[model samples]
Target: MSSLKSICIIDDDKIYTYGVSKIIKNYLPGNDVMSFENGKKALSAIKEMEQNNDELPDLILLDIDMPEMNGWDFLNEFQSIRDKVNKEIQIFVISSRIDQKNQEIYRVEWDQKVDDFIQKPVQVEALKDLLA
Candidate 1:
């Protein structure tokens, strides 16, 4: 598979971040993989990158529940700055909550904003497919 230029993992769970980054590095060596503990931090960093005319990540794995700013809030803020970023970013929500109601809400409300909703403890095959 062709390597991706960059990927961002926004989650407070350190173990999850480490595992996902490790998997990404194993599959797409040399590609940029960044980890942010929360949506606010990621947003600030991305905004800074935008100000400096730096390239943002093409893909983002976001967690719904986070301190400072949650995925829902981030999506709302991201929409405002989407055009400012040069990349056509794809955001996927990776959360532990995957009830039918939540999925339905995503389908009806967040369909345009998010690419996919993945369950927590992401599987290796699923991650590979996502990377592909």
Candidate 2:
């Protein structure tokens, strides 16, 4: 598998963000890892990077629920600017609210927009498999 150059995690939970970032760093040392407390911050930062012609993240793990701008809102905003992006981005929706109905809805509405929908408390093995 190809090594990822950078990763971004958009979530409000500090513990989950820290744990996921640590796992990513452990697997891909020297990789660029960024975390945001909400989608609004992540979206703004990404847009700024685009405007500056700076490097963008290779992957993003987004949470469904957040204080400012949820994952769905982020995706909608991202779609508008996706064509202007300098690099390809792989997005994964990571949420703890994965019931059968929610899973079905995600599969129907976001299957093509995102790479995958993963349950929270994201595991190293699962991440390794996906990243691999």
Candidate 3:
């Protein structure tokens, strides 16, 4: 896979973030990986970047459940700035929820917007695939 300049991870779990960030750093040294505990903070930062006309991250690792603003809420708000943000910015949904019905719903509902959905306890292989 080609190198990514930057990636953003928006998840509430610190351990998960730490683990994923570590793995990413190990695999792709020098890549800028930013993590946010909630969607609101991430959104605010993205908006600020937009205002500054700065380039967006190449990918966003988004978690479905979070406080203040969940993944779905983030998507709703993100839609407003869709044009402003780089269209190449891919969003990958990561969640622990294993409900097949919920998965099907999200697949159908957000297929066009979200690049992919990954179940939690995110695998290194899965991350590799994404990076690929």
What TM-score goes with each of the models? 0.93, 0.92, 0.93
Once fitted onto the true fold, the runs of candidate 2 whose alpha carbons sit more than 4 angstroms away are none
For candidate 2, lDDT tens digit of each residue in 1-132? 557668889999999999988987888577789999998999999999888988888889999999979999999998866777656789999999987788888889887779888998788998787677
All models, RMSD in angstroms: 1.3, 1.4, 1.4
Candidate 3: tens digits of C-alpha lDDT, residues 1-132: 567668899999999999999998897667789999999999999899888988878889999899999999999898788866546778999999846788888989998779988889988888877887
Error of 1 at 45 (Å): 0.1
RMSD score of candidate 1 (Å)? 1.3
Clashing residue pairs found in predicted model 2: none
Cα-based lDDT for every prediction: 0.88, 0.87, 0.88
Looking at model 3, report the run of 10 residues with the lowest lDDT sum: 79-88
**Highest TM-score, which number?**
1
Predicted structure 1: clash tally: 0
